[model samples]
Target: MSLKASDLKVGDTHSERLVEDLKRTQLVQYAGASGDYNPLHTDELFTVKVAGYPSVFAHGMLTMGMTGRMLTNHVGDGRLTKYGVRFTSQVWPGDTLDSTATVTGLSEVDGVKLVDLDVVTVNQNGVEVLKGYAQARID
Candidate 1:
């Protein structure tokens, strides 16, 4: 459900499953769609044999996009005013990621109701993979 200014409290929280067992093929598709075919994302052999990572990992943008999807699901279309995130940890294959947002502030700006949310995304092991904030118009 979309949030209204009156419906939000400082600690109100919402979560959504962002990804289940993130796949290499999905990473390749994201690379193709976003033109971010960095070898680190698409090349497992290179990453493991050369770069020394156990396997290829998901892109930060992919995680951020999933967080965006969570916000959109909560706020509906065209309601977001500002959103940004910081990548905190690597997201690996076979990890389930969940996006969560907590209401942080509520105010009226020029007669428009605004809601501020603290956003975070965590992997299956409960490690924060992304941290961010989003502001949206709630009418």
Candidate 2:
């Protein structure tokens, strides 16, 4: 959907699936793509035996990147000026991520329109994985 700053109102929301039934292969692929080759992300044995976690979990940046994908998909590309998130929980295999962005503020600066978004991503169990805010220019 094309969203204009002038047309957006506080509380307007956009939601989409970020990832579904997350798998080990996807994590490995992400590791390759991002060069994050930490064994904790790609090697279950290292994660469970060495790191002492119950199981391997996703890399924080991978989740953050997924959040970015959700944001761009909702509001369109090249508009995001600022986007950030706090990693709140581990995303394990088999978890599905549902992402949402709510319009929180709107403003204009030097004739540039801006839209502020409150963004969040939650797992299938409704546990928040990432939460943050994003600001984008609306052309």
Candidate 3:
């Protein structure tokens, strides 16, 4: 059954964690796929030497991808109207990440119902890494 926008309830929480850690190969694959080769994200030596970063970091889009997919996977297709996110912290390989979302508000406009989400991502240490809002149309 398709979950319409109104069907999304507020005060609900869905979360997933990365205790296994993200692999370096996967991070390289993401760099190749997303075409975001910032030295801090692709070149470990550059990240350490030039950028003073400990290691290459995962692209923020990669994490946000999981977030959007989580919503669509739960609600079904053609239901997203607005999706936006912000990277609050850097994600490195071996860092376990947990992503979650909760409904914060709902509205209807021009016959389309819209829902806003309070999305967040945390690492193994419980540090907040990413957080943002997403708006989608109810199917």
Candidate 4:
């Protein structure tokens, strides 16, 4: 049988994470893949001198990806119908980024199960760098 959000309870925990180092090479790779070549992400010298950032920064989407990964890994096969996030802080190349998601709401619509998650991403400094809601359409 396909998984359903109603199968998950309020206290059902689905995901956990460890902070990952945001590598400079991955930043460049993401820039290549996503076509987001803003100097704040790729050009360190430009970032430091012109953009005034301390060093190369990761794209906000890159970190948001971690949030997506958490839900997808745990929820499986289901498609997220709505996903949006707020970028709270910058992620430097060496910054460790951790992400997790928990089921916070569940409902059904026209025989389809739906789930909502309180997703978040934080750094090693124990600061919340991203916060958002993720919704999945389950069978």
Candidate 1, run of 10 with poorest lDDT: 1-10
- The per-residue C-alpha lDDT of model 1 at residue 124 equals 94
Q: Model 1, 1-139: lDDT tens per residue? A: 5677766789999899998999889999999999998889989889999999989999999999989999999988989999999999999889999999999999998998999999999999999999999999996
- How far residue 67's Cα lies from its native spot in candidate 1, in Å, is 0.9
lDDT of 2: 0.90
Order by TM-score, highest first = 2, 1, 4, 3
lDDT on C-alpha atoms for all candidate structures = 0.92, 0.90, 0.77, 0.80
Tell me how far the alpha carbon of residue 40 in candidate 3 is from the true structure, in angstroms, after superposition. 1.6
Give lDDT: candidate 3, residue 62: 81
Ranking by lDDT: 1, 2, 4, 3
Cα TM-score per model: 0.96, 0.96, 0.87, 0.90
lDDT of 1 at 23: 88
Candidate 3's TM-score:
0.87
Q: Which stretches of candidate 1 lie over 4 Å from their true place?
A: none
lDDT (10s digit) by residue, model 3, range 1-139? 3556645678777676643488878778877888887767778888899888888888888888766777676555876767788888888889887778788887888987777778888888888888887777665
lDDT of 4 at 107: 90
The lDDT of model 1 is 0.92
RMSD of 1: 1.0
